[model samples]
Target: MHDSSVFLIEFGAIILGLGLLGRLAGRLRFSPIPLYLLAGLAFGEGGLYPLGTSEEFVAIGAEIGVVLLLLMLGLEYTASDLVSNLKTQYPAGLVDAALNALPGAAMALLLGWGPVAAVVLAGVTWISSSGVIAKVLGDLGRLGNRETPVILSILVLEDLSMAVYLPIITALLAGVGLAAGSLTLAVALGVAGLVLLIAVRYGRHISRFVSSDDSEKLLLVVLGLTLLVAGIAQKLQVSAAVGAFLVGIALSGEVAEGAHHLLAPLRDLFAAVFFVFFGLHTDPSSIPPVLLPALALAFVTTLTKIATGYWAAKRAGISARGRWRAGGTLVARGEFSIVIAGLAVTAGIEPSLGPLATAYVLILVILGPLTARYTEPLARRLTRRPRPEQPLAPPAQATPVDDQDTVGRT
Candidate 1:
């Protein structure tokens, strides 16, 4: 076969394999993320077939995928929702983050990694896979339930916290000499926040321009804006994902229904490319010999997230069942974890550490969806009573119409 044909065949195989695995995962009551990783491994250097792309391309694709993911998240939430859910969600988010970070850092130390490496590793474990959790809930037709909304709200809160934490952690890893850069990052974030406020303030007016009768033109404009903001954020040395997210949040309140319709296809297409690209970069051979330590790190981090999230949910007046569900739902990690881990690697943390981090992420990606699938059942069993339904009132009846007729006749 010609080289071009080989490339096409490999690409097609990947897509088909991922789709098949995803469907099969549903049937088997597991999340497809692990299968995607397995597919990557199978096609990777260690496996039978290899698509020998440079690391740069894969990294670029992964970065774009994560930015788009964050943008979608931002598009789904509003400031009002944040405010309303903050009381319960924020505490839960904080607890989960703290639990994941502290124990994870300790585990990293136990593995004989440096403090900076440990801190970054801990941060990776701190975040939950919000996308996976949301997808699972929606698939199960539980998205409309009260608990589903609460879990989603908490996930959003967690994302917001991560948005702040990532930069700080990045700065720390950049070393003491880069304190000025950290300060600059702080200012840039503040400016981004201001820009978001302005966008929200004028979103109604902006929507008029983008929500024309011309669907094609409107979509083009929205896409253009998304890319433009993403670029500007990148130029500012702030996270492009943050800019994309802010844009989404700005437009979320006014243009949600229309925006969803317009962006759905584009989002899915870009997102699939992103995940595929994410998988394409994995060289299984690079995974460090410290597999035992990596596993230990992943286990501790997962447990911490579960315990702290559950405690916070309970304190927030969630039922015992809801608490259990929240805990399990929040334990899965994803793209952001990988992003932070990658940043650490780029910052010269250590060579072996990056692969270790990747392995941990791979594990969570597998476990997150599976745990989420069964969270509801576990919650029900733990909290056992069916919640009472609201009672209906009896129908009102008229006294005999004949009596009224007789009185009128008299």
Candidate 2:
């Protein structure tokens, strides 16, 4: 009874704290992610106070948080959209990877963290925060902007690439033999391909099968199926988040919309927990030692992400203003960065990696909204040249000879 009471108290406090943080963020017109992380830090290993009973529960919720985050992201588009984006926007995706990823990998190598950490850090810098970006778009009312589709396409490609990237990273971190790793990669790819194919071809049927007039039944069915698929994927050495995303892609139409509405609150709640859980595992003192590196990395990657967005928007023929907006919008790195770093930290790849990631994400997540709002205006202000004033042209003199010119014809 005492333990149960303690668990209830701790969990209640967490939820209430999250609620207050969310409200504060809402009032401040910003994402609650950073505040959530700060809260986690305060209650974590090296923070002001740590919890005992509820930590386990928070861990489980954090995992689900990741799964739901990817799943909902997948639900935002159809497989046809994914295929089309892959065909057309792939170059932008490649450029994004090359430009943003190299900095983190180079930093890792320069720090002598070895090849594995370099790869992990590369992933950390490569993917932008889809969740944060989505929120920024909605908040700033930029969802209807010309550059938005270009931004979405780039995000889709990044997420799809994860189906391949996550498996390879998993295998690498495990230090499995080449043959075994290849087998793992093959299986992951095969499953992902099959899911995408089905989503494209028979998505309607899948949606119909899952759909119901009753919201209660619909919620239960969708939630259960997602968790099941995510679990199976994890067991198969693929990312559970990928599995959940595929499941999301397989459902479309009203069913997808309904599921999105039903699951949104849950997604927000657990996602906050996920960020907090990430902070829970990092030592506070460690963050300061790596703050300089994190800031340096944040600065470099911020520029790279802006460049990537600008390039992609320009390729799509967006106006200069829209291109700048697109570039600014992609500057934030939130959930996915931490997700990649969490994997590396779990593998015990580097001691400083987690703290650095935490600090780096904190900086970007806060700076993200500000940049999204100001980048274009700032760019225009700085690069805009003053137009020279043209002297007013003298009024044309009245043609006194007009009558004489007409008289000859008359």
lDDT tens per residue, model 1, 265-342? 566545554545544445667775857777887777767766765676667566666666666777677766766776
Clashes of 1: 0
In model 1, residue pairs whose N, Cα or C atoms come closer than 3 Å (at least 3 residues apart or on different chains), thus clashing, are none
TM-score of each: 0.80, 0.94
Model 1 scores a TM of 0.80
Error of model 2, residue 16, in angstroms: 0.5
Could you say which candidate leads in TM-score? 2
* Predicted structure 1: lDDT: 0.66
Per-residue lDDT tens digits for candidate 2, residues 13-109, read 9999999999999999887888988998999988999979999999999999999988898898899988998889999999999999999999999
Backbone clash pairs for candidate 2 read none
Candidates in order have lDDT scores of 0.66, 0.90
Question: By lDDT, who's the top model here?
Answer: 2
Root-mean-square deviation (CA) per prediction: 9.3, 8.3
